[model samples]
Target: MNDDMTHEPSDTTGPRRLTRTRDGRMITGVCSGAAAYFNVDPTLVRIGAAVVTILTSGAGILLYAAAVLLIPEEGKDVSIAQELINKQTSRN
Candidate 1:
């Protein structure tokens, strides 16, 4: 008769994806998206990126740029090649 016993466990095997946040974003929501995906604070991710950028002579900038291009905005569909093909097929 315990409520906790009646509750089902959440799915832990779901696909983990990174996408830009619609809110709590600064530049392009890269850091915020990463933080949300990783369950960390956005500030921490930003600080880590800053430190990495400083220590790695701008490598962080390149990584950030790649993330911006690759990570889709939240509430938007992922348009990677497979998805694109699926979309094209579904519309037919």
Candidate 2:
């Protein structure tokens, strides 16, 4: 009848966080971060991104940019876009 016993054990490595990796980054680490989150190869992600960008007539570029703004970098808490919004709101 113990609550702790009822709950499942948590992952020792902690929950998988999607953050931009500085080591394997080519641009802003968007593709690499996404690859890590999805457990895929970084090269595959990059190629897929390129193909999508081309097929979408450049819409994928915007998506990549948005991801860069939204996804936090490795070892950082807030995303770039969040920080910018916070600064803007504070100034107003």
Clashes of 1: 0
**Best candidate according to lDDT:** 2
Please provide TM-scores, in order, for all candidate models, with all chains considered together: 0.68, 0.80
lDDT of 1 at 89: 100
Model 2 Cα lDDT, one tens digit per residue, 7-50: 22123378777888776799998887787777677888999999
lDDT of each: 0.76, 0.81
Ten contiguous residues with the weakest lDDT in model 2:
3-12
User: Which stretches of candidate 2 lie above 4 Å from their native place?
Assistant: 1-12
lDDT of 2: 0.81
Q: What is the per-residue lDDT of model 1 for residues 1-92, given as tens digits with 9 covering 90 to 100?
A: 65432222133476766778767799988888888778777888999999999999999999988787678877666734446677899999
The weakest ten consecutive residues by lDDT in model 1 span 3-12
Instruction: Judge candidate 2 at residue 53 and give its lDDT.
Output: 97
